[model samples]
Target: MLETVRRQRRAAALPYPQMTLAVPVAIEGAALHSGKTVRMTLRPADADHGIVFRRIDLEGGRDVTDIRVRHDRVVETTMSTVVGNAAGARVGTIEHLMAALSGLRVDNVLIEIDGDEVPVLDGSAEVFVDRIEATGLTALDAPRRAIRILKPVVVEDGAKRAALLPGDGFSLAFEIDFDNPVIGRQAIEADLYDPCFADDILRARTFGFLKDQEALRAAGLGQGASLENAIVIDGENILNEDGLRYEDEFVRHKLLDAVGDLSLSGLPLLGRYEGVRSGHAMNNRVLCALMADETAWEVVDFVEASRPAYAAEREMLAISAD
Candidate 1:
C-alpha cells in the first residue's frame, strides 16, 4: 500500500516539483549601495524551505540570523526591495537575484550572504542566471504551488498603477515613462515562463540619471555604481561607451524588476500583472491588496504534467486591464 501511494505521487497528473540548486554555488562582488566587497552562496534546501537569506556577518558571525524573502517581511522600498527579520537583520537589493531564481523556477534555496546588500554584478541578472544554470537545479518530491488570481486586484499611487487580474499561468506587462529623452515612454509584455526572460530581460542593466548621482550618493545609495555595473544617463546620451544591450532596455529592466519583486509573493503567481510607471513600492502594494482580499486569489498548482505544456500559456495573453 505504501509503494502504491508513492507511485501515485509520481503520476503524470501531478504538477512540477519544487526545485533548488543541484550544488552549492558562490559569487562575490561589490555591494551596490554600500560599496563593500561581499560574498554570497546559494545552498540547496529541503522541499518546503522557500527562498531565505541568512546574514552571516550579523553579530560578528557568532549567531545565525535569517530573513525570509517574502512580501510581508519587506521593510523598505525606497529605491530597492528590502526584507528584514524580527531582529532587524535585513537584506537589500535582492530583486535581480530573485528574478534569476524565479525565472528559472527554483523554489527552494538558502541564500547565505556576508553583507547587508546583495552584490550588483553588472547591475543585471545575467551573472546570477549564469551561475545558477552552471550549477543546475534539482527537483524535490513536493509539487510546486502558485497564487492564482481569482479576481482583478488593483492599486494606484498618484499616476502609478499596478494590477493583477485573473488569467492562466503567469504573465506581465509593464510600461515606463521617463522625462529623459533617451528613455521616454517604453512598454513590454511577455509570458514570464517564456525564453524571453533569459534571452532578453536578464541582460538589461539597471540605470540612473547622472544628475541624481550626487543626491543618491549623499543619501548613502549607489556608492558602488559605475559604468561597468549600471547605465548612467547624462542628458540625452548614455555615458556607457558600449551602449545598451537592448534599444528599449529601460522598460525591460523594469519588467525584470517586477519579476523579482512579485516573486516575493511567497509562491509563484499564476495571473496577469499590469503596471504603469510602477516601481518596487507599488509592486508590493498590489500584492498586499490581493492578499488582503481573500476572494481575489487562491493557492493552487499552476501546471499539470498530464496537460499540454502550453495550456497555461494559451489564456495568458487574452486577459488585459485598461
Candidate 2:
C-alpha cells in the first residue's frame, strides 16, 4: 500500500509539457467588491504566453492590457489581491480564479474580464474548477517550467508569517487563529499536487467576521459580500444556513489563497509553503522575498525519472508526520 501510494505521488509530481485550455470558457457573475455584473472568458493561449489578464471594458473595448501575474504587478493586497499594468488598468480579487488555474496545472491562459474585479462566484474556486475541467486541458509542445526552492525564504509582518522552503512537490501547511471561540485555532497540511486539491481546497470559501462587515463596506470594500458568497462568523456562531463545509475550513481557505498568491511567480512552484496567520499581503511578500534572492530558488524543467527521488523526500516527511 505504501509503495502504491508512493507511485501515485511520483506520477503526480512528474512534470510534463505545458498546458492550456482546449477551448474557451466563459462565466458571468457579480464582482465581489464592485458588486457589478461582469463577464469573464478563459481563452486558450499559446505556450509561454503565461497567465495574463486583459481588461476589455476599458476605452470602448479598444484597450487591451496584458497584466502579468507577478509581485511587481500587485498594486493592492488590502482586502484582496489586485494586479495592474503601466497603463493603470487593474484587476482585483483574482485569487480564487488563479487558485483554480494553479490547481488544474494550467500553464498558459488569457483571462479577459469585462470589469475591474473577477466575480466572487460562491466565494470559492469550485465553480471555476468545474468550468475549467469541462473545457479540458490541451498539452503544448513546450516543456513546463517550475520554480524550485533551493533555500528557505521567509517573510513576516508582526505576528503574521509566510515561508517557502526546499521541497520535492508542491505542499502547503497553514495555521490560523482568531480570538472568537468559533475559530480560535486551526491547521491543515496537504500535497497540493495531489488530486486532493480539487476536493479538499477548492470548495473552501473565503470567510470574514460579521462584526467587520460595516467597517469593510465603509472602506469601499466587501460591497457584495454576504452569506451567499462568504462564510460569515458572528461571535461563536456561523451565520451560514448550511454551516461549515469543513470544521477547519477557515485554514483551508487560507491555503487556497496562498496557492493563488504564489502562482504569481509565473510558473508552478516546487516547494513547501508554511503560513501562520498570513493573508494576501504576507503571501505576496514571501513571493517577493523569494524572487529578490536569486540564490534561493531556480527554475527547472521537470524530468520524469527525477520524480521518484522527490517522492522519496515526501515519504520521509510523511514518516516524520506519523
Give per-residue CA lDDT, model 1, range 1-322, as digits (tens).
2212223333433456788888999999999899999999999999989999999887744234888899999999998999998877899999999999988888999999999999999999999988887768877888889888899999998899999998766878999989889999999987777645687888789999999999999999999999989999999999999999999999999999999999999899988999999999999999888988999988987562222445443333223211
> Candidate 2's residue-wise lDDT over 96-208, tens digit each?
99999988888899998889999998999999998888768887888888889999998888889999998877889999988889888999997767756789998999999
**Clashing pairs in model 2, backbone N/Cα/C closer than 3 A:** none
Off by over 4 Å in 1: 1-14, 60-64, 304-322
lDDT of each: 0.85, 0.86
TM-score per candidate, in order? 0.90, 0.90
Off by over 4 Å in 2: 1-15, 60-64, 303-322
